[model samples]
Target chain A: MRKIVQIVLAAALLVPAAAWAQQKGGVVIRSVSEVEVKQKNAEGKEEVKRVDATKTKVLPGETVIFTNYYTYSGDKPATNVVIKNPVPDHMIYLDGTAAGAGTRIEFSADKGKTFGTAGKVTVRSADGKERRAAAADYTNIRWTLEKPLNKGAKGSVTFRAKVK
Target chain B: MNTRTASIIVGLLLCLVTALAAPQGAAAATAACTGIGNTASVAYSVAGAAQTPVSSNTNTITVGNKVDVVVTTTDASPGPAVVPNQVDVLLHYTITNNGNANQRYQLSAVDLATGVTTSVFVGNQTVTDAVLVSAGTATTGDNAGAALATTATVAAGGTLNVTIKATMAAPPLTDGAYDVFALRARSLKVDGTTLEANGSSTIDSAAGTCTADVVLGDGAGTDDAVAGASPDGSHSARSAFHVVLNNLSVSKSSAPYNDPINGTTSPKAIPGATMEYTVVISNPGGSSATAVTVTDILAGTLTPVTGTPTWSSTNGGNVPCTNQAVANIASGGWACVGTGWAGSTLTATIPTLLSGETATILYQATIN
Candidate 1:
């Protein structure tokens, strides 16, 4: 009688264990880590750098110069890198040049508010007051480099513009 | 012996009942199975197709002319979806005067499928061509001659910027699907210069492509079917009308003997010497008949006629023939008829006119 009771109890436990294994069907919970957000300054400086407002402050009709340095780090070459800079108020933008690749430049008339094809920029006299606004009335300029920037190599473009 | 036998019998019966219940419980648990089976085995398929690349796209210009080319790609779907539906390729080009003399090249865009070509030169300059295509061939042309082509001096370089936008067609495609397209750019040769055979690079190819699934439900029938019962049991109606006024006379003639010449003459002359105009008004109707009013509202160089206007028999009575009190016409308000014209609405009315009437108001004015 004792042996029979032991056999019945063992069979009941086995039945539950088999049923649990079949229902679970080998599902494993994966551990996932959250991604951190990082912010950096415009000059590519990771640290907090103070920009001298006086150096960057430009007056109307005065020219301001900006130099851009681009370095690629990936294995494949970077062919087209679009660099856009908004034209601040009272200033006009100019063309830029790089050594190896030729440059194609354009400007936007709607302040740096919106950029479009050269023909799309329309300039009409605001209230017909003799001042003409046209596609030529560009506030932003863009340059496309003809040659690709190789990995680990740096390229630079220089531009000069006058304040409006 | 009696007590032991009874106990044994009860035990046997209990054992039999438990055996029957155990199998039933197992069957019930198995019947509750609701697993997803296998997701990997359920495959989602998409129709993969290859599109022909653009070849021989060209823009012609004068010696110092520029043109822009925009290349765009479209997916098979026409409606908006969660994924990107279009891509843009901008090309800024110029015709340079490299030779000893000036040359001209005709510019055109050729439909790859139909082979029908269209000229694209504006005035004496080369106009950028924007091409839209589905899964077929496309190309543009340059360098036909002094005839309707781009002309440029050898030393001058004309600048142009081209933009192309490829829009996807209707119907949503499944996610992770792609549509392929090609762009071909070639220059036409004029004079002794051979056309450049090495076409420009492919603007875009099949790279990152994605789409989303969109489901639509049946609502009211789209065609002229009634959506709901109208409150008044009347069918809604929509109509439009236009009226043109012609042969009206406006001049700076001498003032009538009874009226005083209190206003000054404008320095600017009336348009066409005689003020003859055609008035057009459109009414989109609902419950109210849209008011159509015509008023002469000119400032500075434009002055209204001193007397009332004469209307054709078809004209509505809204515009009076005599010079009434001046009223202010709100920037976008109706013509003020009676007394609101004192401040800024001189020479115009302030009341909203009703629909389907032709009212011609004649006024005279001089430039300040």
Candidate 2:
């Protein structure tokens, strides 16, 4: 029994320290939306109105604003903070809707893994001819912060897409 | 065989068998991860350290409860009424659920306003409510007045026709009197929540609850969070109805008079004899007839008489159409004879013939 105990302790010491290390710092992401509404004004002219999109139903061919919020709740600042959002199915990303201050916006034709600025990203056609990708060709959106996000600091990036 | 050679052969066979069976076990282990969840991962780096990656807890995006609808009236201008007050005018409207989810809608009729003249509905008074009926098609059905049952549900991308049978006001409304009817619709949720009208919401798959349902975006962001216990909400619109009438028709006849050979009451055409012509314009509807003008064009072969034409109504009362205005119209048409007529034409302008009334014009012309 003494020999068995000695061997068990020796085996435990051989395990890597990284296996038990706790995560020190991280970020949290949340998403929300806004929708456009049209109602007749007192003069009976159609006026555009904005409304909350929570639990709201959207029709086909309508526009929706999708915002992704990111907050750093870590012990240390995080660098190269990049956020990515895939365009929802049955929706087309509206051009010029991506907006985030101090962030570089890029679009992806491939699923969120690779991104480039519009007119710079090139895709090969079925006939093997290469052409600059249009904004409508984007399937994913990415935002890379210009500065490191300090702990407890938050920022949001938004874009609009139209229901197909 | 040599022992060394036989042992090597046995070892090679065993290695081949193990390689073939290993992939089957790996494939079985890989097939067990089918579940409902979303995946999100974020990566960051610390000073002097390589980037570390952390994956979010399995989150889910639920299908949002979005309610959008549109209501439209069928006709803009309905015309040519056969009779007023006796005819029940049926107006049609279609309500469509233009949202992304199924929904129930409540409908009601609001009153048409009085003398404030507008081209479309602008008032909100609930008048004598008309009978509302639901039908599969917009046409070919009649239903009595009753509140639409609460259970009537409209699916996304579906439409329903609502018919309002408005009984025309008694004592016959005056011609050109207008009334407007407005149709209103409100959407209801199964949880008894009235969804906002003509609105929509979207769920963020990365931030929404992938593990469980979590409702967010409560009016703080662009998305309006539906207040779960709020009152039912509605969208409103209006349509107008105008009073008008069908026109009256005119008929003409002739008889031979003072004939030396044939009888004076003969219906045949004759020469060297006097002929009497009668023009009758009748209004058979319950609406007033406006701009009643009768024109009689005589052939140049017939000479005009020296006397004025006599006019009468349905009650045998003679209309004093003594003076006439002879006007040139299109060819093959008739004009009423008047004092200024140098040609073979006759015309009488009688304005404002009341409903259910008839007017007649009698003139005399002789054969050349």
Candidate 3:
């Protein structure tokens, strides 16, 4: 009887420990701050009048600049904190200027199959002239931090380009 | 039981329970969470559009004539809509001249659609004289059976007055809606004139055409007529006339040299005497007149008005006289003396004239 009681107690403690480990392994992502973007016309008037990012029908050659900042609030340092931005069909990527440190930038020319230096990728023109392509020419852009971002660390990226 | 044995038993049981419970816990966590949650979104917006009231005239113009049509558009919204608020339209036209003389042509308009026809005549007269005449559907081409004649002669510098009537065919347009039309005119001539072929000479000649367009506000009372649909639709204009002249004259000094002035003139001076004659003309209508030329025909001793007529601003003016004898004038060619006098025709052009404006010419002859 004594042995049985001890075994039951040990089993209960082990069960809880295993469950806790599994829970710790699962990722729990939450938005720490709201994302906001803005755009203006040639007259410097804000054009946020009729934009619904989630459901708006954007026309060809129309531009919407995204000025967004995000924060990581999880306990452990977040690895591979990649920001994957899909380039819209009608928009050419302009710039990826940083708002803070701990952010590295890279671009993909072939729809995310591979990434290369944003400033070093060469595009050949129809006349056989090779020229450096802009970040906007890529299918997507990713910003990887040099080190795992600690909790409560915030950073931002700004992108601009014309509608093609 | 012994302490060692009890501890071992407990460890083994614990290991078994943990192994069993670990899988169960993971399975339970794997199940997706289900809950009834509601999401709501609110948005505010202001929508607008640029409204322009466009107006124009129809196509099909008479040869050697022109029409003026207007098309006006207004921005309907009080505020600005999206960018690029422009409207485009076309004006189709045909011009014809049914007279004997060749005619020069020009056209102007704001919109290509409004069929506003304008032409010069001698005063308010039919196009019988050498001048530009407006050809309408009722009167086009050389067929006398079709075209209406001008009331006065188209002197070289004389202007004619004409009125434009825009007829809107039923189903009145909406108050703010735009109505666009077109007008065109051009000169016309016999097609085979340039060829050497001895083509059959026929009075039926092809006339040329020119056109002008204008944009006006919706005639509807609900819309402002002069202001256009928007605040940016206004225009200013000035009117004037340009004139050109060609002179034909004949001279004689003795009684035996009495011969009526014909298109051909020889400058012959009698040994003992001298004579001179002058002619004058004027424009008494509205609008510019053009293509003016003078021709002198001498048939007998009677000396008709001498030299081409001079231009004047007033209605009636005496022509300068020449010292030539009047005995050689043709019996029926004398203006004042006989009922058979054959009057001569002189021509001039004013190019353009404004309302209440006038152009004149004078002629005179003397026999010594």
Candidate 4:
């Protein structure tokens, strides 16, 4: 009984240390807004560049790119990695904008109650009738990585939304 | 007739509902000062066991005010036909708020400029300024509401009806004369003090916690406004006053009734010859002419004959000329039409000779 107690206490202390390590070097997610700006390059050619949206004015009817950058710094690989984001209030998601490398994109029209790929999402309006969800009806976006993210792996998923 | 009237009323009501329900265009947007923010989350498992989900820092940016509006003249082209010297002619306009916030506008009207001329029947414009009035109803009912230089708060996606009350200024306006006006609206901030700035103005560009700024979104309207910054804070529409005048003319004809030498045979002017005269006034216009006076001065050799003056009016019809002697003028039932004779001088007056109307006066005189 004394030996079993000592083993159990050791296991309990080890679990917390692992949790602390995970907390320190686990997945890190950062959201950024991108704005397209047009300027003359060195060759005097008109070129567009993505700038941080925080430094400029964001008005209605303008498109904003919302990007989530992630990195896995844990010692072990991460599996079933999924990222979820909501279509913010007063903004509508643009179709054909949800993109990530080696990932499958899904949308939720009923606020995460159910999810499906673009054309399969369904929405029920206030009239109690169901209809195929359009890009504007999507309330949430989810991206699932197809492979495990190895330690020190970093990637970004992006979606564009326009102010209402 | 009642059923026909009811149907017309129904049609008008339907139009009113449609106008009130929907604004003209698709410039609607999120309200200004509203914060839009989002936070992302992620879920993962390490070594086949689920780890607690993690959430990112919420990224937020405030939506700025999109200051935009569209102004259009509701009055049909070459609007209401105003006769010369007519006052209080009204023209209608609408200002639709296409912005994301409510707005009050300082209103003004001026002639369309940049050398853009409007025409048909072409005549010089007399009126330059107009007193804007808030329209009380769909119809410009006597230019209702007080003369206003500004408007009440117009909510987003809403419209305000305005009317221009102007005089046919500087009368003696030639027939078909017109004065074109552009009614302009300059947006004022909701506080009623500061004028709204255009997108080109320098403003704090910081993007968090609901900092509202203005972005000009109006197109160059009929007033020839430019599409860029400063002046874009205002929009204008076109309206006009057209002159519709009565065409009136008068003429006199003289003939020999009898000559002293050759009685009733190709009579020529001779001393003591009896002469007959007729005076006619005709109006061929869409409007009526009132208080028209005709006078004839027969100096030196003419003498008036008593009880021979007679007059009649056909009022645009080819009715037989009915005559009543001067002695019966009192009973002619036309108290407004009169002819007076004082020693070879003749005068005729008509009040309210309607459209396409004619009046003729006949009298006998003698050459002394």
Candidate 5:
């Protein structure tokens, strides 16, 4: 009986230590909004400038940009990083806007259950006919990293949506 | 240093610059963004073990004002015969709000009076609730009969009805008095100005795409929405009233009289002669003639005797002529005789004479 009790206590202590090690080698993510503005440069030429989105009131037919930033602040390398975002109501996601280097972008028409490339994701139309999902039909977007994220590495992904 | 040695040194320096300018630690990543007011999150695995996922804050946007309305009138040509000062005309209108939001429409009217020498008299404006009518049917009668509303309420995808009535003034009407009835509608804002598209106000805008009520455009202004052309080929409405007068004819003849001095009888003009005069009246138009009166003047000094005037149809059917005061109108009596006989004139009155119907009067007058 004494030998069995000593074995259980050792196993419990080992498991928590292992979990703490895993937690120390993790990544953190944050998101921010940006807006495109046109202003005249010193040469009097109109130039586009990206600035923080500060507009509290947005009208229909207006477009806004959302960017997700990720940083691996861990003691070990993070692998197979994935990012997913749902499409909001009263807005239309701009087609072909998801972009990042060395990353594979996919779209989901059924929330985030399954994902496919453009013209591959299929869904039933209002008439119950099966057809390829359009950009407007995309309900979620995902980005899959092709390489591991080393410690102290940072990257960002951006997409655009227009108010309906 | 020699030229070849200098060239070798420059090549080495170029190679070093290229190596120094090479991209450092730039990792390729895949990014995708799509959706409105969606949640964005990221997750990763360390050494093949999944880590906790992170989520983004919710983001959202705002849709403005959309306005639509339709107005229409039922009758195109409401053609009917009317006696001047004896008929009231009624017109019907329908206003509909086809938008997604509730709306109020301001109402008004226009009298085209097309080809009319004198304008029609429209009064006692009354409106009532009504259902839509079938094609080619005239709008008449008062369902509600309240005063015309300056503004009418209609829910989105709903309809409201309006009815207007006007009376025709008395005679001096032309044979073909034609006119048009045009009804105008405009959307009013809370401030009573025109509504502009996408404006914050639900009522109306200061400026909009709708120009005239009858103009086929958006309903941003009062003049922007209008009832379409009635079936009568007018944008508003069309009506014609036939006006005409009735006619009459009269004649006189005498029988033989006995001369007191010669004790011989001859059919010659003499005093105390019983002369018979006959009068005929007829209506030859598509309308009935009412309150017909006939007055005769004497060529010579003839005295009207106290007797009932005989009345009959062209077929010789006779109706009794009763003596009553001329002021006693609407007395169902066949005819009215003069109360007291007078010199040089006789009179008769009949209540009504229908189309193609006639009345005859017979009485004797003695020459003085």
Candidate 6:
């Protein structure tokens, strides 16, 4: 009985408790990360192979690509979709790497309190001065879908970060 | 932008904690098993009503351990000065662990030429918490009570000091003999003193969940580290022991002065002629000799006409000396006992003679 309860509890923790996800024609989101590895192809030409970051050794100073895939299955078109992701601990966000089709990108340096265009973002320095934010200073990234998404519309957003 | 104008900007924050995903390595390598996990969230509205947001699954990656060490000679200046047949010449070195994890090291000292380990020490000591303890075991090598352990375990960013002791061979050592010793230290595994190797399992099957790998990251040190490897696993330093004894030497010469045939120039030691004798006492080694005195005698055919002997001092090399000729009084001049041609007996005293220093003494004698 205890084992059964533990299994159920584990399943419950893995799934989100949002009512929209339980209903049909709802949007589903999936997040994953990977690293680019150099390998020789059949033609003997060097090519970059994407390896799953979670299943491989990621050392310090190595770059990791974090991606978010989304699918809209609603009966009507969904609008005003916004996705935000915070920079992971011990990692620095890469500049101009947050990309998505038909979406407006913004950055936040103060832990998502406010957002602005990448160049317009600012951060306070240790010497009591405010200056333009560097790539490492970005704490969160926001992607706002520019167009409405109908049923079965699928797209993805991605950004690169380096392990500290 | 779209026909629908419903915008809520919902904040859906999900706290998914990953094990071993803490901030690490403020100024050093990150902890080997640190796992960095991230989770992203999304929020949207259907037509006009805002819906509860959802978060994606967590993804985590672990950091690998980088193994590196440093060994350096930390002996005091002037090194150890040993005399002939002297035992237990001491040299010191320090080993530091620069890796992210605790590690053990194998330490030893060998001859630079023959690669033979002849300087094993006894009574090795370890100090902790202001308390002293020694591994008191006598070995074949002459010992000044240095650290004698062949293996040591040190925490990350920790250091250990080792002393290597050597004995000078009597029959082979000259006045200035030299011996070179190499101190080597290699990283070791958990048991039985095995050398640490670079880990090649790039894909650890279950790599991402807080499991760390090992990599070589130490640079070559004094030819002890392997240059072929990307980074070497061992470090070494060379220190030398010097034999310094032969410091005292004496040389003397006599010249004719004020002779009837030749006065002070082109003169030989003829009858009724005065000769000037210059006695040089010098130190040629790397140590000091104190309370030095020179004794000479002039009698019979040679009579001492010396008012006072003059001496000058020159300091060079490892020796430090000053002229003490004013204090050097020649006693017992013209003293003879039942003898023919027993030159005047003269004795000059010098307080101290340093290494690489010379003192010249001159006096006059008349031949009859």
What TM-score does each of the candidates earn? 0.19, 0.45, 0.30, 0.67, 0.43, 0.61
Arrange candidates by DockQ, descending. 4, 6, 5, 2, 3, 1
Worst 10 residues of 1 chain B by lDDT: B6-15
Task: Check candidate 6 and list the clashing pairs.
Answer: A25-A73, B296-B346, B297-B343, B297-B344, B297-B345, B298-B343, B298-B344, B299-B342, B299-B343, B299-B344
Q: How many residue-pair clashes does candidate 3 contain? A: 130
Better of 1 and 6 by TM-score: 6
Give one digit per residue, the lDDT tens place, for model 1 in B1-368: 00000000000000000110111121111110011110000011011111111111111110111111121212222211112222232121222222111122222222121211221211111112233321232323212211112222121122222112233222233332222112222232333233322122111111111111111111221110123521110111111000111112222222221112322233123342322223333222211122223343455444444465443223233455354432222233223244323333443332332323223332332333
Quality of candidate 4 docking, DockQ? 0.33
Tell me the tens digit of each residue's lDDT in model 4 across B1-368: 00000000000000111123344465466776667787899999766656668999887776777778777887776676766545556667788877777766776555532344543223345333333334333332223222235445567777876666655544355555566666677777656656677543222212222346677776666553343444476787777666666657767787886788987677677888777676666777655666666666776878776553333222222222223212112212333234566656665566656667776655567799
Writing each residue's lDDT as its tens digit, candidate 4 over A75-143 gives 677888999999998899999999999999999999998999999999998899999999999999999
- What tens digits encode model 1's per-residue C-alpha lDDT throughout A34-72? 112234868776764333222222222334444444444
* Number of backbone clashes in candidate 5: 23
Q: lDDT score, residue B112, model 6?
A: 43
Error of 3 at B137 (Å): 17
Best by DockQ: 4
lDDT of each: 0.27, 0.50, 0.28, 0.65, 0.49, 0.61
Model 4 CAPRI quality: acceptable
Question: Which candidate achieves the best TM-score against the true structure?
Answer: 4
Q: Residue B226 of model 2: what lDDT?
A: 28
User: lDDT: which candidate is best?
Assistant: 4
DockQ scores of the candidates: 0.01, 0.11, 0.03, 0.33, 0.21, 0.29
Question: Which structure is stronger by DockQ: 4 or 6?
Answer: 4
* Native interface contacts retained, candidate 1: 0.00
Interface RMSD of each: 31.6, 13.0, 29.9, 6.4, 12.0, 10.4
Best-first order by lDDT:
4, 6, 2, 5, 3, 1
Q: What TM-score does candidate 3 get on C-alpha atoms?
A: 0.30
Clashes per model (N, Cα, C within 3 A): 61, 29, 130, 1, 23, 10
Fill in the DockQ of model 5: 0.21
Q: Per-residue lDDT for A34 in model 6?
A: 96
In the range A115-146, model 6's lDDT, one tens digit per residue, is 89989999889997999998889999989999
